[model samples]
Target chain A: MPLTSPDRTTGPLMVIGGAEDKLRKRTILKEFVSASGGADARIALIPTASSLGDEVVEVYDALFRRLGAGEVVPVRPQSREEAHDPDLVKAVGEATGVFMTGGNQLKLSAIICGTPLGDAIVEAHERGAVVGGTSAGASIQSSHMVAFGVGGATPKQRMTQVAAGLGLVKSAVIDQHFDQRNRYGRLLMIVAQSPQLLGIGVDEDTCALITVEEDADEVPHEVLRVIGRGSVTIFDPASIVSNAHEAKRSSPLLASGVLLHVLPAGAAYDLTTRTLVPQPAAIDPEDAAELAEAQRDMRQLARDIAAADASPAALRRRLARTRTKIGPNPDPLEGPVS
Target chain B: MPLTSPDRTTGPLMVIGGAEDKLRKRTILKEFVSASGGADARIALIPTASSLGDEVVEVYDALFRRLGAGEVVPVRPQSREEAHDPDLVKAVGEATGVFMTGGNQLKLSAIICGTPLGDAIVEAHERGAVVGGTSAGASIQSSHMVAFGVGGATPKQRMTQVAAGLGLVKSAVIDQHFDQRNRYGRLLMIVAQSPQLLGIGVDEDTCALITVEEDADEVPHEVLRVIGRGSVTIFDPASIVSNAHEAKRSSPLLASGVLLHVLPAGAAYDLTTRTLVPQPAAIDPEDAAELAEAQRDMRQLARDIAAADASPAALRRRLARTRTKIGPNPDPLEGPVS
Candidate 1:
């Protein structure tokens, strides 16, 4: 990590999960506007994914304006050709915040994949502009996108399909409407397939504020802050012991030791460390037995993961189960139902 | 419409829905092999969409061999670069039958979308080779692909999105796992957005054999025949009066008079005429009033459609409720639970 770089001042990326409230409170969109310089923020809207661009523009323009945006303008490329329009590129380059509407994620990629306007948006984000999208918009943020995957809560070899994405978050893949759509299985399959990447499942009405904080040494550490109603579930597939690639196409996948962290609203995470940052003044209960077992588990995991043959792809290539066996009284497989 | 063209002896396109049985009476695969010249067929298996490529290949390869196929070969392309290899291209070009395995539809598109292999497969099909795909394989056959959309039985403005597809069926869009996934709402949204396009929803264990036949006049007419177990749902959105495009992003979609036809095994559809063809020994209903009502509905539809301003996008631009109202009583919204 670049010790909090003193020179880099790019604004944080606010990736909102789908179904953010627009009728009541408008919490997520409001946070987005405030972070984007509030009243002075010039937000550019891209509604290329949906058929009704005019109506989509109207709804968002009204909502953002109501949330105190100084000027909300729509950047509509009627066709892929218009995506390269110099005027459109200039508008995006000068904007403080850009928001993409939910529709077809592929439509976004189809039109913007190799265009000059796409390059302009990238340049603006690198400078200081805040980029945001929900649902399909959110899915297209990662370089490796879950183009369209099947729905299920169980990990399977056929659960996820990935495609090229916008490349905003190179290290992480974002899945919007996560809990609502039951996309945990889909995300798990993706993580199992590519262990080096981080899997982030953002629940409906939730937002993951990814801010790159440069320390005094100029190391840029990406810190994730949870905002809005639901939580962001993080999956570190690098830690998962999986044999998905070797399993038959008809078989349910076998994956063990997938490091998972659920950060509810108001929580924070250190992306680089792959750990949840404790909230200020939060305390841990004094359970000696549980704490000891946890430490023991950690030690065993470190030993196994540090082995010479324990490379990232090794987990997927072979049927090698994690050496760190589960301790007595592990968490129940079935969650408590309503 | 084509005048019975005996010259073009190309085999048909077999698009199967998800979950075809392999253990018991492998019917869909059997039909595909038979159509591709039976025992002498040279089948090329493309398992790029599947995460378990080796397992997928083994299963299909073994199945074909057991079914008495002469030769079965695997076309394995590890990366996008390999998709353009001359060997791979030539293999696809010369194959009598090509089958794509089920997994990530986007993976198939990712590896083959713009490559020479994709083109070669298209050329092979044009020259008499039978091409078949299951699940994700089935969804990529049309010129327009349903990228990803929201789920619900009731249609909504944000229900579907489309992108460029493989173009096997130029005027139609295909959906796999139709009934199992409850994809009617998703497919409806797509048809509402593009009324001129035909929406085909194929259920699990089902296959739709699409062949271009020539009439006496020499014009090609595409005919679809249903095979396997479950039914194929066809939606002709040309008569629909839709307000999907003009509605607000959060609004529920409004579409009416979208002609729906569910055809079971042995049923056939004339895609060019947008009508279902009568089976060899099938007879018409004896109800005179009902038949007259149906004819009246058809005539009204033709008149309204011919009255100008009936373009596919026309439905989207305005909230013109369908003039051809539903006959008799309509079913209640709440469906029966298992």
Candidate 2:
């Protein structure tokens, strides 16, 4: 007895893991453009994580237009007042594809959850519209979303705090910047607390396109995935050792489990069957060539950064300052010593 | 905070789903007669499903000897063979309690999974002792235990399977003879597809006694109940649902995603948390008095059937056939037809 009828969206979802500079951006754009079944499809870019300065929006608009999107809409919801704008919601509703850019996921959730715009996004997804989110955007698709955590292999109790997120996917809790950041420990800790949810660690430059089809009988939907490089590491706890109700701030994290599959690009993972297999290579040769060109452009950017006319010390200092500005700051008063 | 120290096993485990007649015989006896503390703390029993069988096991060996228990064990396997010998790898290593009892539970996970003797039951659980099973022998302890679905819920595509059990509690699945013949739809569907295991369903007038530590991290270890009145229903779905890769079956009837809970004689519910609470009022004072009187009868012989006779017609027929059979029926064609 199938739970629902099969429904397919006209466009495909594209999720990028992060570190999307000029080259990476071009590659993602090309993929999106081609997946939309021609350049005529309307595309809506949600850059909620960025400050949305005029220059950034203009640059994105130009880039998307050059990539063949007939019309590109940059959604900049700066304040709570604009977060629920009806016009923006309608634009997303009417668009063929919706893209979420990298930034702070917490901020996005804070501004979107329970709002009309949020409802519209969910509705569009259910209607089979192509919806994609990068970095933090990817992490927000689970019920028990990770706010942040220290990286390590040891499981510590209460090391991770879960917050509400967009309820798009239920089978797994996703973490971005996987291998690059050594986030396996954090993912394991999460599964220890809630063994029901599978842990999906998506590395930078990787994407997981989850497709859901209602069972023929329509009780609950079944989820399928098209996985791409680098790899998606799955953390499945064999047995849980932590207690939720009695856990305190000082509990040691302890979990014993298994890592079932670490699927690479061109792989398909079936949630219904809990299995992974090779997916038919679907990217066109032309599109693949374009992607390679975009990679070259990214390498050029990195080379330029390395060759900049500055002392190594100065460059390190500048990078640290930039990180502080973009990332979360620790509370000064809570420091270990004066 | 950490719930328990890594050095010691946390609190005792208790199962309370079946009545008194459906529990396994050997499990009950061991749990009731074991010595308290030290190695005896690792005592455990796997009751097929019921409290009566557990009680009988206690009194079977000696009329007046007081039994001190370190632990009470419950063995609810995915198949019968899994339940019978049980891979004692974990139990023997650490259990202080161990017991096995008689409800179907797909014949105790077909003698337990991954086993020389269900590795989880005899070896892992026995290391700590205090193990027992009752009425499905306290189903819901195993990771792959069973849960019955009634009340018009159909098995649709991805609607969640309604047989055998959820494997989380232990690795075994469980079903109870709940509300007499009402379990017909619940039991048959569960065992249709996933038949590599056992199905335990306890009938009325039986119980399996599993013991846990008195306190774990300051919180007392209480009996975890999987109770059901009348009859317990068990279904193993490994056989009915074909495993053909390309050929899709309509609502494969396997014992995956089964439902199991202890609906004891009580009415306490946690609406906010969506959890069950104990109902003290449901325990009849008269029954307690009768139990005391029954304890006085030192020479009573344990009978196969209870006088109350609350089992469903279908289960009664199955149990009768199984008892009369002398050898294995080699013709696979003679198995139950969907």
Candidate 3:
């Protein structure tokens, strides 16, 4: 197989695990919006995976709007017939970003997998639109989707079933709520049985953001970087030894020597090479400045505490006195040596 | 902390999981012998950890000799006083490789943790001798060692305990017979309670071979490369969220966002940056040549099958006829282009 295939699109994909923080730091969502063109992003919100009615669409509608997205178009295809609607296809084709919500992945695939709307979404991605999804939405981005599965640590035969995904991620099978729901076994079983496919298990509140990067040879390689609160676990079975083919029912199949990678935020992996990419050398300037300032404040506080004989009240009073003496634009490091 | 610490010695370490296969293949042991200087290797065998007497040392003594080692010196110390013996220290110091046998890790530390012979092992490593171990020997190579632990998937309070190690692998705790014994929870618990420490779990028949390499910036980074049949699982808690401090007895501790990496043979991880390192770009010449030969043979077999009309016996007869017609040392690809 070719290292880099032409099957993938040019646009970025945000494959989020379930229960992504909607209230607090919506870092994953914000990234999707920013990738889709920031304030000018016209997002096509696909709530077909979600069992809930308009409420699911409304939730994302408000979230995208609050995050400064230009417009939100609800494309809810309840059936295969509706999924073929020309208007829905056009709406997706016009979007700068297409998003799928969480619910039953099977329902989502049944309704939209081979429909005109699905084709339109793929076309839009090819034309440089961002495609983002959560939970079931995340699972549907891969070539093989996990229909359902039992959870555990050992790879048992007949433990899980699989269905076809959008093939957006290519040769991968994704499972959401990984460690939180103990879904390691099912994912393991899937990859063990089908050793050619890479198994990816994403934790809740995390996103495996995939983008295309041209390497030194100008080969466009798909790179997956982690974002949000948890991790993205990858099981590379390229060199695996397994008994999945002949194991009896419910028997734990031997899955030995699988290369697994659990990447947190800031870790980037090359899907083409199945290797981790080194992080950029330069530290963010703002973060560096903030860290320096914090160090100075900590040093000043330690000096004040020593002067105050370790009394909390005395230390607070001393800090107040020093702040007044140093004036409004004072440097904490300029405080008294003692 | 400095990326490369002077505290770590110059020697390479072969930290193997318990129950390494002594019979067939013996790939891991063969690697250890080769790394220890092949036929010139004078290995120091430390059996202080094993409860059984001379047998533990004898097994390795015979294996090393068979693997073409120059000599095997038994450095068995039954007590702290014996560990302090100058003769034992000198033997370890003079060795080209220091190997510790599998047994109780706590007992190993009690007798040798701070003794003269232990210091000599460290000095030998610093002087560029290979240091290798299996099971308990694996645990003692890290800074924090797991003494004993219960097994499960969820990290719970008081699930396991830790002890000081030889500090060879800085800020890391290692466990052996990992997934085979369901030791994930205990390793998770250890790293969850101490987020600063990286937790490594090795499976039976696997070895994590660590070596140092200089980067483009001239920074020397210690890299852990997997070898043998199973894998090395790394738990990076650099950005973990844990409730280990306040969790009551047996209560599950929250260990969210801990980066976990399970690496198979040929996969290398950067210990300093706690990231997966990209493998070398070039394929081995031998491997390439073998792959080409296999491809040619397969193509020739398919052509023969097609010519024989899918009859196995007819295909065998056709192959024999072609072999005779082409004489000896004939190119398989040169057979009739039926």
Candidate 4:
């Protein structure tokens, strides 16, 4: 399992969706450790996405340790001057896993782009270290980062601004807070303008673990999943109807050729083939029944809240506030009860 | 006032900031007509920005007629299928002034990036017809159009994405909704990332009418004054300390090495000299003095509301709501009865 060999497939790179409350954090960490080739893996924690705050790093370190990571080193770059620290670059070069915490992807790219540290991180991934980031970190992994946009399904020109990215994967532009934020429109615009690249929208709390193939003859990578609740939206614009100057008089914002795919939880997508195949429904029926029962319990909780003795107006306000607190959309039973 | 061969400036092309808004509508028809030339300026409207809806040619026609512009033409490309219309190419070739409307700039670029119409637009600008656009139209007037960004003052790598633009002006990247949206950070980032280019942030309800100085043997274009309430921000990055990558270890966000100039109403900045000169302060000193004196009115309003014998909590809530409505930083004189 030596990933250094030219023919060896690199370790899996994981993208964890946000909202890592205590119990959920434990599960995610456990998965991370296992994916990084067992309990003794050396993990590098990048809290740039979380504003390089000490408190966030401490929490991440604690969580990783709880999940049995042998060592968790927090790499905090204080200024552009320190972003080029040789020691930090060396550490990343030898890590078994690199975890980028959530804050701002642009901030992370600002610190690492064109520097020795950025080169080291890319080199580490090439050498098969498991690379992962959440929230903003996930946004930076793609070649084109979704800087900001007015969200929707309408692919208008200039709807989305794309900025420099970490260049972890060049085939697609990655977007975080996908389903929860209604980022479909923004992604579509990105693909329409740059039809050569694909768009991958990762929903909240889900993880897309991409792994390179072992043989050189095959395409470099494939995506594995530990999908949580929502789905991933893939936009492929292999076919495009565009005439550069002819669109001057009419609506150039209207795209004539585009394809979309929504990948639900437990489905695997091959990047090379650009297709989704569901996981075989071969799991024990008893496990399936238990999952169904858990779902039912969650739905009942919603009904109870709605049918409570509170006034209708008060109940409506409460529901709205709760929905906002949880996010645009939330699955009540996806994680363990608090 | 013919904007043809006899009256053309021997200087570089001048791109006015507000093209479609002032020229396509009847708002400043006289000014548009006079600017293009007396009564007979052949005009073409590129409504790429407003392409999602109905063709905006009627607005252009009415505005042009009011402005006394003869032969106002509309070129509509029905689909990506009809992006190549020979008549459209001929119309552009014969036009004295071309106006691009505010819509999706990317759509304009996508359709015209490498087409005959695109070539004609560029050729016309080079041959000396005033080129202009509002918002997205304004964005495409530059060599690169800024799609969008999370407004702030932080300069990070890959924080700005540059799409192929009309290249009418190669000096700067233009951003709309500048001061209104606090987009200083993204603009500064653009200058920092690309030090060679200048960053021009145009505020809403304002325009930068640049004119080529045909008589000047040295500098080509000169910005004319038609100042409104809003201001423009210019970011010059030639003096920045761009070791942004070195700052990655401590924090990814770097806010260093950007020179900003806020050009207020009635003020003009010489791009060549990079100096701001006031135009005798257009606001009447007496009016400004009266406005300053009105600060006492705000306090009086607050006290009056407080003394009205209302419930203290209710009164407090009302005051907070009013203040919020007025904005965090509002001109004290801009309240009720002002």
DockQ list for all candidates:
0.02, 0.02, 0.05, 0.01
Q: Candidate 1: where is the Cα deviation over 4 Å?
A: A1-7, A215-218, A282-338, B1-338
Best by lDDT: 3
lDDT digits (tens) for residues B169-205 of candidate 4: 5667888766455564466556656767778877665
Q: Estimate each model's TM-score.
A: 0.43, 0.40, 0.52, 0.42
Q: Write the per-residue lDDT of candidate 1 for residues B1-338, one digit (tens) a residue.
A: 22233225556888898899888988898998897778889999999888998998999999999888888889988788999899999889889999988887777887887899998888887788898999878888887887777654335567677876687877789988875676756787788778778888887898989998776787777888888766677777775555555544544444454555556566677777767665554334544455566666566555556654656666533324443454342222221211
Query: What TM-score would chain A of each candidate receive against the reference chain A?
Result: 0.79, 0.71, 0.83, 0.75
Model 2 accuracy (lDDT, Cα): 0.49
Docking class of 2: incorrect
What residue pairs are clashing in model 3?
A: A260-B262
Ranking according to TM-score, highest score first: 3, 1, 4, 2
For candidate 3, what is the total of clashing residue pairs? 1
CA RMSD for every model?
Answer: 25.0, 24.4, 11.9, 27.4
lDDT of 4 at A275: 51
Whole-model Cα lDDT of every candidate shown, in order: 0.74, 0.49, 0.82, 0.63
> How high a TM-score does candidate 4 get?
0.42
Model 2 chain A: lowest-lDDT 10 consecutive positions: A1-10
For model 3, residues A156-215, the per-residue Cα lDDT tens digits are 689899999998888999999886777776898899888889998888888999988888
- Expressed as tens digits, the lDDT of each residue in A1-338 for candidate 2 is 11222245423444456654445455555666556433776777777766654665676667667777788787767666787898898888887777777777777777776677777777777676677777877777666678877754334456666777766666568888765565655676687777777777776776776665554565333444434435555655433333333333533332322323454445555555454543454556765786676666566446547856656776667657856886743332333223
Q: What's the CA error at residue B334 for candidate 1, in Å?
A: 56
Task: Show the lowest summed lDDT stretch of 10 residues, model 1 chain A.
Answer: A329-338
